[model samples]
Target: MVRYAQTDETRPADCVIVLGAGTWEGEVSPVFAERLRHALDLYRSGLAPKIILTGGLDPRNTVTDAEAARRWVEAEGIPAQDVFMEEKSRYTHENFLYAGEIMAKEGWDDALVVSDPLHMKRAMLCARDFGVTAYSSPTPTSMYRSTGAKAKFLVRETGCMIVYGVWRLFGVRS
Candidate 1:
């Protein structure tokens, strides 16, 4: 008999918020596409009944991350009514703050945060600061074993953790 680790009790939220990632010349990058794919999987797996695509238009680019994600998900057959877009945020902090407001207005208390695995820790902290009980659903990486990629992720995660710690200590709300 195989015994699996017990998973956390994750109740379905009114929405799942897919945080933005970089796009290459208006197209979704592989990392960004992975996040969207995870969000879709969450929906299909009954983790969340709805999804919120969060990001803003890059001044240099014509399309917003939210729009790109929405288009991709819709192409995958998710209904329009099941997707919400928060397209005014240009940073991770703004993504949580703006989306948190939307969730509150919609009477949602819980959310599944979909993002790169390396980002989920800080993202969850930011979401919690906004009064949302956020749970992370990291997008699985195909290159987790790459030494260079792992090093990059570690550096980024460490920097984010430091920033988040300072933000929380200073009573900063973002």
Candidate 2:
């Protein structure tokens, strides 16, 4: 896994929040698969017993990213009951909000938010806004190996962080 700066909080978390990376034909994209693989490692290490996959419906694939991830873990031997699939979020912020609510109900904290590096800042911000105590655990690698693709994601993520920073500052509820 891609190791960022660490602290005691990096110890075993209560849950692993695997953010979606889109799906195609009900299968996980390479980007999403990396997140799952890391999360699986965490689970096997006894870091967390539950994994929550967050995403909404994909018009073309006819299944949510959460479902696709849930299926992956189940196929990998994670019991179906241990996976929580949130199939209502259509965007990054919603991913935190919806999943945060579920976490609140379960009294979960210290959730590791898994996604690519560029996407982590905004995601962690959204997690705070949603009242979720989350920390980033970026995938060690991403499918976007091309320079153009990397630049595009970084720039877009910077813009999203700026926008979301303002949104959170204003205490907007969603």
Candidate 3:
């Protein structure tokens, strides 16, 4: 099992999974950029051999968060071939489950998950449930900004965790 740490180690993994963030008007939000930046940093530092961008198009929204992440990563010069997309998940649970399936198919055992700091714990939980040894690489706070915004995100993440826990307890698909 991979141990969580306050700072990233830059140790290579089988893969690095970039969790999706909000997008606005076909553009990635600052938060989204922050998450992608962390994933890119991890990739460049040799923390992972491949990057998996995860998210799906919101039925009411035009662009999928995964697609936007891919575009930004490509613009940053990461080769298209090195970036993988999981575009069927709309939530964290689905993100881990779907990405885990892909990891299993590829025989990946270790992964570093990049996401907002507030969501790291739950994301790690989901990853562990999927049988992957996972660690967190939080997006920098400078990129997230605004205490109000971070607070809101933390609240939402906690709610998601609670809901997911109850669902699992009742044998419901999260």
Candidate 4:
């Protein structure tokens, strides 16, 4: 996880994918905000021509993560035409599944996957599983900055990776 987080594969792609974290009452969490910031930087640098925001509704919130992120990026002056939304996924796998569908419709086969540094491995795996040629572009500043917080997330990510591996072995698609 540490090795993958330290790598940045930012490059021109069909689009920039901003993976969703949870939001509260339509306000993006700090983690999600950082992902957006990185994605925006990539967009501004001309790495990609479009941005795809992936996230669905949370039970505790009135709006989906995609909606909240779309609002935030639009407020940052991203035009509506350059922003796409995948608002039916509630997890990382589903995020790419749904985003893959969007990419198919749009004729996009590659993407710059944006998310927290620790989350890049799984995010890239999901993207590849869903048929996207994914390049990692992790957020520069992760919310899990402290040693303890980073360690905790690392453990959680290890477990998640194991579970995803098992699911892949079983041919689970979502």
Model 2, C-alpha of 64: deviation from truth (Å): 0.6
lDDT of 3 by residue, 19-108 (tens): 888688767888778888888888988878799999888776798888888889999999998888888898888888888888888888
TM-scores, all models, native as reference: 0.87, 0.88, 0.88, 0.97
**lDDT (tens digit, per residue) of candidate 1 on 99-123:** 9888878888889888766677677
lDDT of 4 by residue, 31-149 (tens): 89999999999999999999999999989999999999999999999999999999999889998999998999999979999998889989888888878888999998899989999
lDDT of 2: 0.81
Residue 3 displacement (Å), model 3: 14
Against the unseen true structure, what C-alpha lDDT does each candidate score?
0.79, 0.81, 0.79, 0.92
Question: What local lDDT score does residue 51 receive in model 4, on the 0 to 100 scale?
Answer: 95
- Which regions of candidate 4 are displaced past 4 Å? none
Q: lDDT for model 4, please.
A: 0.92
Candidate of highest TM-score: 4
Which window of 10 residues has the lowest lDDT sum in candidate 2? 1-10
Displacement of the residue 10 alpha carbon in candidate 3, Å: 5.3
In the range 133-169, model 2's lDDT, one tens digit per residue, is: 8877776677778999988877777777777778778
Q: Give the residue spans of candidate 3 off by over 4 A.
A: 1-10
C-alpha RMSD in Å of predicted model 2 compared with the true structure: 2.9
Model 1 TM-score is 0.87
